[model samples]
Target: MNQGGNKIGGADSASRAKTRASGGGAPSGGSPALSIVIPAYDEAGNVGPLLEEVRREADALGRSYEIVVVNDGSRDGTDRALDELARGDARIRVIHFAANFGQTAALAAGLEAATGDVIITMDGDRQNDPSEMRRLIEKLDEGYACVSGWRRDRHDDALRSFASRIANRLISKATSLPLHDYGCTLKAYRRDALDPSQLYGEMHRFLPVYVRARGGSVAEIVVRHRPRVVGVSKYGFSRIPRVLADLALVRLLFKYRTRPSHLFAKVAGYLFATGALVGGYGVVRGLGKAPILDMPVLLAAVLGVGSLSLVGIGLCCELVMRNHFYVLGRRPWRIARTVNLPDPAATGMVSDRTAPTKAVQGHAPL
Candidate 1:
């Protein structure tokens, strides 16, 4: 691999040979150096051409890399297409889920299977050009833990694009990550910078925040975005509500990831204090009045009960979080396929280290 340790492309061939000799299918001794993970759902028409284009681009970068494609229980011919592609290329690996687990789950699977110093994630649809992968990798060379791609000139229809912009803005504000295009799937991440276990729901869009929460830095770069050539967009207007709902969770994670009890306690405490004050007022007023059977007494009673219930719920959450982290040792992500190869150190974006000395030939820009 690149002796510089931070070089964008380099691999230890000797270590890889040994790994293969021992029956390991993935690069060994961290040889691949780069891993590209694509999550596909009913992308039968796109996977084959997408893989070819990805290989062309990756080869141009002159890096030893692996391409991992996750078939998210596609009801189409995606399975056969991936099978055919993998048959001809050893660097290509395909994983199939038993049922459609959504994009977040599919991406998590790919991340687990990835064995590279740097991991790259992109959409399986043809919209994200493979040639832009270099831009993201180059950004990674700049010592950032994560580099996100911003589709500056989105090619989607007007309504979809507008909705995406709103959602992206909301997420940026909620997580305090300040990313321009959280919806863009094209992003590059350093191996240690990513915590796949911290992701769930549609929170994949908050990857930069997840990494930043662990003391890592993030950056954004402009990349080409094309209209989908095949397969329908699985997302629609309905996803907006789900994403908005997830933002609350993201905010909680931002403020109290390691201390769930803090958030719950804070809420419970507020409710309890408010309820106690109101109930006390009602009691005093009722004692001085002719009768207490009115809205004020009922409201006070409801508040008191609600406050108690909130406190109890908060306590339960505290216990659950403790068990989740300490007792169960549960992870946020899972992988169905692993190459288990030792990969080389995936480096950051630094001109001195990652800039290609010679122009890569025979490659056309996508």
Candidate 2:
């Protein structure tokens, strides 16, 4: 992560000085007990009021809190607005991306930068109500590693809402983590429950699923959703394909993340069995009166070749998966600059830390 932003405010300078003096632990004061992370993209008109609402709710919590906002290379004045917000408030931290790296990347950067024991994530468009934060935190306190938000009364258009319902059902069925709203970003997580390295390509929405897979308890609550009042929606029907693709990836990881060859080997076994049966029939006929180079023999040969190819591919995938477990330096997002944050190296971004593998209560390992 690069730290090369043009400095603008005295508050940011003062916070940086305090962080440096503390040796990247916490600022002059104690570390925040809560960290709210919001990812913004072209939401210049929305984030300002959103942060104000967050501040109000955070202050009401009576815990030391910091708001970490990631500017996702917005062409609008979103960067300037975030800078202005961070300029005055020492608790507001702004991370600027080199370019638009999508919401997952932005969340990854914010999670890496967050120093709180409890972290909450929400949208920047102000559709998620700040008043609902207390409900999520209370649920988190009930021995749950994750508390996801369910937008029961969604304010989106009918078509989008229907699409969201279908997507949520499909994701729930595929990942086996039944939740009403997987698309909602208004979720709270324990700092230890999140592994920022697993985030990429719209995987932010699957955080609860990932946590559950790692044996962390997850709970969902009905949250209030308001209509977008300022900026345009960043998502649309175009994201449907991407959502489906990421869902498939999630299913694959859930079932075969540790042993991918088993998945491939199962399919290959069926192909090989069918080919052998056909080849046996071909040989039986050839031994009687049929020609050796018959259609059954040719079909069997094709299936046999395909089975062998699939087995080879499975082996290659196993090797790739093994290597992935050993290498963790490849991150999906790049940072252009940061305000009121220490270097990424000191924040465990490149550390050897791994997620907890114990199973959560009432959930069996897949």
Candidate 3:
């Protein structure tokens, strides 16, 4: 549970070889049919039962599967619990973060470590029912790239539920990806539909939107929700502002990710026009014996300067965006250690599987 170092922890060589033989390692030899990713944060009591339930359900599906759990720097005994579980079950792979990174970072780590044709993501607090996983998988088999779970009857405090409803409505309208429950973590997706590098901040809730923007079809279905019985909820009203900010970021990335200069140019054009109009009015007033250094002329000058500055910023952002897409990439979090997971280098892949492009300057792999 040390948060100061980046250490690599795993099973013995024999266990790893056995895991690779059983399709529990990298996808080089042969990947599992399904990969279930759960992000746990101080969910020491719930992680064990949840994984057991998932194992039972996965066995019922009659397909090879692996469960990837991310220990997001839990202060409790969650990391030790995961280590014990992984020792017994080769299908269970664990990733430990160096510090308490948020849920989005945990999901990014889990998604990158997973090696499966289809990936399922769910909360580790046991609110999402494992028995309903089949429904999501079946829905995915119907030619949809992503299948999201909708909690029609959510079990939570009235205030939190109300806020969630409003937030979901606003997010759906903003992203143009409608879903009854964007906050629900129980979802299934094709491996190709996800780009872990695009995830930052609280963007995990907008995975369906990202998938759809990449030409993938998305679907949603009603799922069962259980009230938390073990640990306290990690979310609160404090996260509302962050969620709103992330929503605005999502909108900007979706609409103007590639050519953001167009959006800036349009705004600058309006500013320039308004400044011209104001300057013309100031000229007209001056001809009528009004003072030349009046408020109108000064306001016009400020607007003109603001417009020019915006244009410059737009050009700078364009260059940065181009560099991000073509040359450099970013990862917002770092991994501390991994258990029962293969090294990407051994599989002929870069260390940071989340980043498709080269890592940005000063963001090297741990």
The lDDT values for all models are 0.69, 0.75, 0.76
Global local distance difference test of model 3 = 0.76
Q: Per lDDT, what order, best first?
A: 3, 2, 1
Worst 10 residues of 3 by lDDT: 2-11
Candidate 2 residue-wise lDDT, 235-332, digit = tens: 98888877776776677677886787787778678777877787677676664576545566666578677766764565456446434532545455
**Which clashing pairs does model 2 show?**
215-360
After superposition on all C-alphas, the RMSD of every candidate to the true structure, in Å, is 12.2, 11.4, 10.4
Clashes of 1: 20
Off by over 4 Å in 2: 1-29, 269-328, 345-366
Model 1: per-residue lDDT, tens digit, 299-363? 66676677667645654564455335322323333223323222211211011113322332221
Q: Model 3 over residues 150-234: C-alpha lDDT tens digits?
A: 8878899899999999999999899877777899999988887677756666879988887777667777888889999899999
Q: How many pairs of residues collide in each model? A: 20, 1, 0
Cα RMSD of predicted structure 3: 10.4
Task: Give the per-residue Cα lDDT of candidate 2 at 293.
Answer: 57
